[model samples]
Target chain A: MSVDAATVRRIAHLARIAVADHEIEHLRGEINNMLAFVEQLNEVNVDGVEPTASVEDMKLKMRDDVVSDGNYAKRVLANAPATDDGFFQVPKVVE
Target chain B: MNAPVRNPKLLKGDKHDWQVVIGMEIHAQVTSNAKLFSGASTEFGGEPNSHVSLVDAAMPGMLPVINKKCVEQAVKTGLGLKAKINKKSVFDRKNYFYPDLPQGYQISQFKHPVVGEGIVTVDMQDGSSFEVGIERLHLEQDAGKSLHDQHPSMSYVDLNRSGVALMEIVSKPDLRSAEEAKAYVTKLRTILRYLGTCDGDMEKGNLRADVNVSVRKPGDPLGTRCEIKNVNSIRFIGQAIEVEARRQIDILEDGGKIDQETRLFDAAKGETRSMRSKEEAHDYRYFPDPDLLPLEFDDAFIAKLKADLPELPDEKKARFVKDFGLSPYDAGVLIAERETAAFFEEVASGRDPKAAANFMINEFFGRLNKEDKTIEQSPISAEQARHDRRSDRRWHDLRQDRQRPLRNRLGRGWRPARGGREAWHEAGDRHRRHRKGRRRYHREEPGQG
Candidate 1:
């Protein structure tokens, strides 16, 4: 799990982000620092203690299971770069 | 229009007992109107960045105020799975840079996942059931979607989904087959739907699965699981597993070592492509999020959640069987989706559970299947179903056979469905209500009148 500089560089490439060489060292440092903090979490005895996923305790306000809104096709695609037949257009991916 | 779906199983040669080690990370979008930690509307379709708040956009001065409802939903999900609720937990910063993530780091539950060990039981067609163990369920915030090819060069980001609440339910490497995995996800989705925590819409990216697939020689230590990224549909996940497993088997069989890496399943290409080396939890450099403090709650609060929890799918399915006298399959199908289950219960209670089940499973649900319509979109009301039972002469004959008015008792009980299946039948046929049966009783068959 120790993210080395080369791994950082590879991750950037795979994630499609352009990272300068000097920044790789900075990324390495940041990753290592984060790992150090995570390492501290292991000291706590969580053998049987359940982990908390959600922070609060309130019910999600239930809505009547009714379809209320449907006439928003134009609104939905208003910012689309390209669209056709009420659907967003993309480079043909399947063909 | 349908495209030819190339089956991967065909190309997968030989039924070798390669230990297929599979794990899953399922992300379910919490059914909430607002974002997880912000008041911004979480509506699906909105203008680009319209739903983005200062907090969601990662503004320097912005702060996150947790949505209490989201937490409750998470707890409800945990409780529904019969998992323990934690008294205290912390949100950590999973730092990774992605254009879609306005904040350089995603706020997620890491070391202390909210829920711990649980089990999901899947019924096989052979009247047997298998139990799959759940490792953990963690919470996180969703990132925006980056739309490439929107223009020749410029990629657009839709913040409508950014900062939405998510529960990442992780499963143990217990599955050995595609069918089992499918059943696991199906059951998990059912439990969530029953709890009213997630909308469970895979097409809209509300629910997605990350499949960890690997192959090992039998009795080999757990193989290195290569995580297949972001399969949005269940069918696609199954297909990805088959393709990835076979690809690995082909490599190992030919003396190639399996590389532990993250791979992407290009559904369009019908293949998996190596993306990069899989990153460990440390690679993200997770730290206690400075913006938020560790979440702490009392047992009383958890008890309240436990108290208010809806009858989970399994319990409800069993209740349908024990109380309503429904077939296990019918009960299972009805409870798989929450609303469908509710609609079935509405139709069944007071009416003969068997007759109501027949109409729901056969008459209403069957017709919907024939027309490729969803139950939510169906025009049928429970009222019309009851009316059909009362008025249809064939139903009356069945009632005579039973020596009692089953439809009458049901109508007397829940008046709406008592009107009968005519209204639902009318939904599929624009003119059926005006043309169909008027007698109050009939046998459950065609041409029985």
Candidate 2:
């Protein structure tokens, strides 16, 4: 599938990234390149092979259900650019 | 079993006969100590951002690791519902933009869920039961809370709930009425509670549902469904379905079309309002996450989990009916919760099952309701019931011994009351005597008590 300027703009909007009109063509070409690379893999004949999501071929490691971490409100909120009363404040979102 | 005939209550409308079809998507928080992919605590009501971790906050270079217990809990719940457990399941990134969601995309299961089709049997209040088909149970990460009340121009984000594990159990559009929808959710919550997978506390937002409602003429093809999102209570689920169905019926009857969209139920107003139009909806570009491996387990693992499962509600109810000869309704009430079922077993064991049922339902439960307490909060103990049972056995023996002499003095039909005060006093005295004899016997026999 080829990516057009409109599709690139839509994707950028969906991703919440501000892309200028002049940069849409560049973004479209970059996305098309990635899509073309992904599409090439579809051309290979592998009817009998199982689809692989990870290369490790191993089970996902699981941790015990124990609460040994957390309770660091100060440290957790430290990375936020904006904060209020131990919370990460953001621009108002109304629904 | 075929789908239950559409509930007449849902079918009968003001102007014409209309049928309401409901499908539920219940989101139950998995009972886990930590978040789905992060080590942050999953405890509720934490101070804002207190329970968050680097992964929960969506910090750069953070990766998600699967919580094995949460997966096991999902599989256990699936088995309890008699659902097929997929040996392999994939996780996908559901791309969306929300301030509460720290990550631009939510890690969810789409196309390939951990659980496959299942069936939940819900018992109605009228001593009837119907099976609701489960579409699938997918694992997803919960977003954080956006506190809109704290500021005039900004919303405070609490990442404490972010990355928490949620089992999005989707049910087929098999429910016919608001009652059935409520019953279906009630049964599903009970099963989840029985499996210890979720607490099923809708008040705490641990369990919530997205109810899909539509109206149609009887025997007509299914109508367009408008989803009421995040209805948090069972009563509200029923009310929302009814209100939305009425709204649709009114629209159709007035020569208007019901738009397919997501709406929110106003509990205060007892109506549903449009939340988002279809034209402005998110695409949610779902794709397999490259960071995490597909979850796969063998038959041995499934078997082990199945073996470890406590006797589920349906099985316990069936045994109550078959072994204890309890009615299906009584059995259902008894087995609605694991604690209640265990308490029933303790009280009903080696006693008159029907009498035990009456005591539990009428006296025990009645007192509990009057006092506004749950079984977990009940002042009465199961050990007291055991003591009562022992006394009951002794009373039965004493009655048998006195039967001949009493028959000789009075008429043969004359007998003691089932739970008369006299019998209770006799049982108490007998218990005291028996205890004294046991103490004497222990004194006589060294080292035995």
Candidate 3:
């Protein structure tokens, strides 16, 4: 699908990325180019191929359900921009 | 003679016979030792952020590995619901920005959920049963808690809940009344608790529901639905549905259109208020996460999980009816919770099930209710109950006569509860006051010490 300026703005907002007004045109062009390059695969005649979610044909690696890590509250909250009485602080969010 | 089945109460309007339809999206926190993709402790009460892992905190280089027990729990829950366990399920990035959610997007199942097409049967108080169709059950990550009361201009985020596993079970719009909706959640919670998948503690925020309520004419096409989000209490869920149905009926009767939007239930006000307009809502850009692989398991895995499944609420209820010869309503009440069912089974083994039901239901439960005590907190022991059942003459005659008072006094030194009801109430008042003073520390939030 072709990308438009308004669509690019929406996409940027959804992704939580700030895009400048002048940068929308450039981003849209780049996105449309990528889509077009991927669309070229439509010309291939292999219709019976199964749709694959990933390139790797493998099972998911799993970890045992055990509490092996944690109890590092200070380290966990070390990078927070703000911290309160033992909690990471942020600007008040309205629902 | 068994009384005729009573229809569930319906809302009567001015002229139109309005019908209420409800659907529920329940978020049940999976019971696991660690978080969904992190090694963070899923323990409820800990120092804030004390249970956080690098992955839970959303560090740059952190990656999520699938927790095998979580997937197995989800599958077991699906089987308990009589739902299909999809062999191949994929996780998607549900993109959104919120302060509590450290990651910009949450890993959830969108199109290909792990469980599909299940059925949940709800038994009503009036000796009636109805089946609610399960659309799907998907595994997702939970967001942290935002404590708004800690500061004025700032909200504190606790990463303890971050990266925890949740099973979002969605139901079809098959419920007809608020009572049915409440019953559905209760039954669903019981099944989940039985499966050991979720603790099903609503007060702890382990289980919360998003109820979709709509109103329509008796035979007219379905009406637009308004979703009330994040209702944590069963009583409030029933109230929300009833209040929302009335609100919609008023709008439709006044010749106005009901907008499809999300609303919040204000328990204190006993009403639902608009939280967001449908037009301004976020369009969550869901896409398959590239980091995670597709979750695929064979039939043998499902069969093994199935083989290990405990007897669910329905199975136990049926057994109670067939073996104990208790009424359907009595059987439902006895088997509502696994602990209560087990307690009853142990006390009633080799004894008259109907007599046991009577003693347990009328005498034990009545005393517990009067004492304002839960089954877990009951002072009476099962051995005491068995002893009372055998030696007490009142128990042998309680079957043929309904008016006979239970002569067996609970505990060692306690007096008979039949004639001392008033005295007990007075003592109960004193005990309640004493307990109230001690309850201050226990009243804190589940995760807060």
Candidate 4:
């Protein structure tokens, strides 16, 4: 949609992005371009046409309900920002 | 539609043909020991830069070494999706600039994906079934996560997600409503979970979707759609589609225009805002990596995969409905999550199926959710496992901590409290008599006893 300058600023604030005032003009173009592309779908006769999500008609295969997990204590702990003897270290809960 | 779609049902508040044309691109984390291109551990929640290998970090001298396991996983995921598994697939660079992307471009599959043409039929809570089309399932490496919450001054980057194998499952737009979109994503996640290919945890960022949405009149053409990027949860996807569709309809009917760009979903306000313009595949200038060769698989291997294929969710759901005499809807719910479905079978088989299904769905799941635990963490037992967790844990340790102890001793045959009152009284009497005998023996020989 033709979102206004103020609306663009409001949206940027909502999305928590740092957008400059000059960037607002750029965003307007970018957003306009995107909408134009999606609008192309309007040209196709989709009255009875169903929008497809996937291309096939099958279900997902499954394993025997099992509990498979990692046990590499060292491996799991290897990338910890901070570690104790065998655990990830966090700030102590108690004073 | 908030727009001028002349649907009688919508007038009556049905929005039925509020037909949500939902399509999804589900990014599922592939289960593997290493990343797609490097030997870095494919794990979740690691410190920044730790899980990153030379290739992931885009080292000057580094070369891409395709992880065969990741490739196999992509093929396996394809097989599970009933898609055409392409043995000959090439990796291309999805050119994009993100702070989290160490390589500045994602190593993704373009024209040649490992899996092609799969379909998911989401049986809604209602009796109707909606078929969502699967376009292609490709292999790619995940970018790092940007942790914005921890600090206002600095955005921390966690590369633990970097190089992790991901199967980007793209779908054809077949959804007719926001509910259908949610259901489609839910079903897709269930399938992925069933295959044991992904953990399918959206909150943990293991699985996510980039939602493409639009609106059109029933007989008129499709409207210019907007792409809502990287929505992490199904509920949010549904919300985003609804908001976006309404916005498009409003704009079109109001003589305004819909902008085609990557938008962000504000779950708090239930709206989508523009993020950036969507880029074409050509914009990325996709080209095959010279460092890796196109993989080719033999027929024997494919046959092996087919033979080794486990009972999928549909089969299991149908079987649960048939063998266990559970309702189709109940079976679907039971089988929606893989571990829960397994727990249901272990509890249902050779026991009261109705009771088992009820407990698995109601009590077990309720408690687990209350405790904020996953089905993978559920402490429920499988009926077939002869020994308990101790023995299985030993086996896992012996297997070098790969296999897991897959059960808790919520042993079958524990009759419901209300139904087995007589049996409970009888057992109590017997236990009391045994205790009396023990007391007598202790009085006769206290120290010896």
Better of 2 and 3 by lDDT: 3
Q: How good is the docking of model 3, by CAPRI class?
A: medium
Which of the numbered candidates is closest to the native, going by highest lDDT?
3
lDDT per residue for candidate 1 within B249-312, as digits (tens), equals: 8887777788788889988888999775345422687878867767667788789988988878
Chain B TM, cand. 1: 0.83
Question: Chain A structural similarity (TM-score) per candidate?
Answer: 0.69, 0.88, 0.84, 0.54
Q: Which 10 residues in a row give candidate 1 chain B its minimum summed lDDT? A: B440-449
Ten contiguous residues minimizing lDDT sum, candidate 4 chain B: B440-449
Give the alpha carbon lDDT tens digit for every residue of B1-449 in model 3: 01123353567888687888889999999999999998889999889999999899898989999899999999999999999899999999987778888888899999999999989888877787878889999999999998888788988889899999999999998888888888888889889989999998887999999999999887678899989999998878888999999999999988999998899999889899998633343587798998898898999999999999998889899999997888998898888778778888876876677777877775666566546566676565565565552433455444453355433443222333333434555757766776642321111211111
In model 2, residue pairs whose N, Cα or C atoms come closer than 3 Å (at least 3 residues apart or on different chains), thus clashing, are none
Q: All models, DockQ values?
A: 0.08, 0.64, 0.76, 0.03
Query: Which one wins by lDDT: 1 or 4?
Result: 1
DockQ computed for model 4 against the true two-chain complex using alpha carbons: 0.03
Give the CAPRI class of candidate 4.
incorrect
Off by over 4 Å in 1: A1-95, B1-16, B277-282, B390-426, B429-449
lDDT score of residue B19 within candidate 2: 80
Provide the lDDT at B349 for model 4.
59
Quote the B-chain TM-score, candidate 2: 0.85
Question: How does each model score on lDDT?
Answer: 0.69, 0.80, 0.82, 0.64
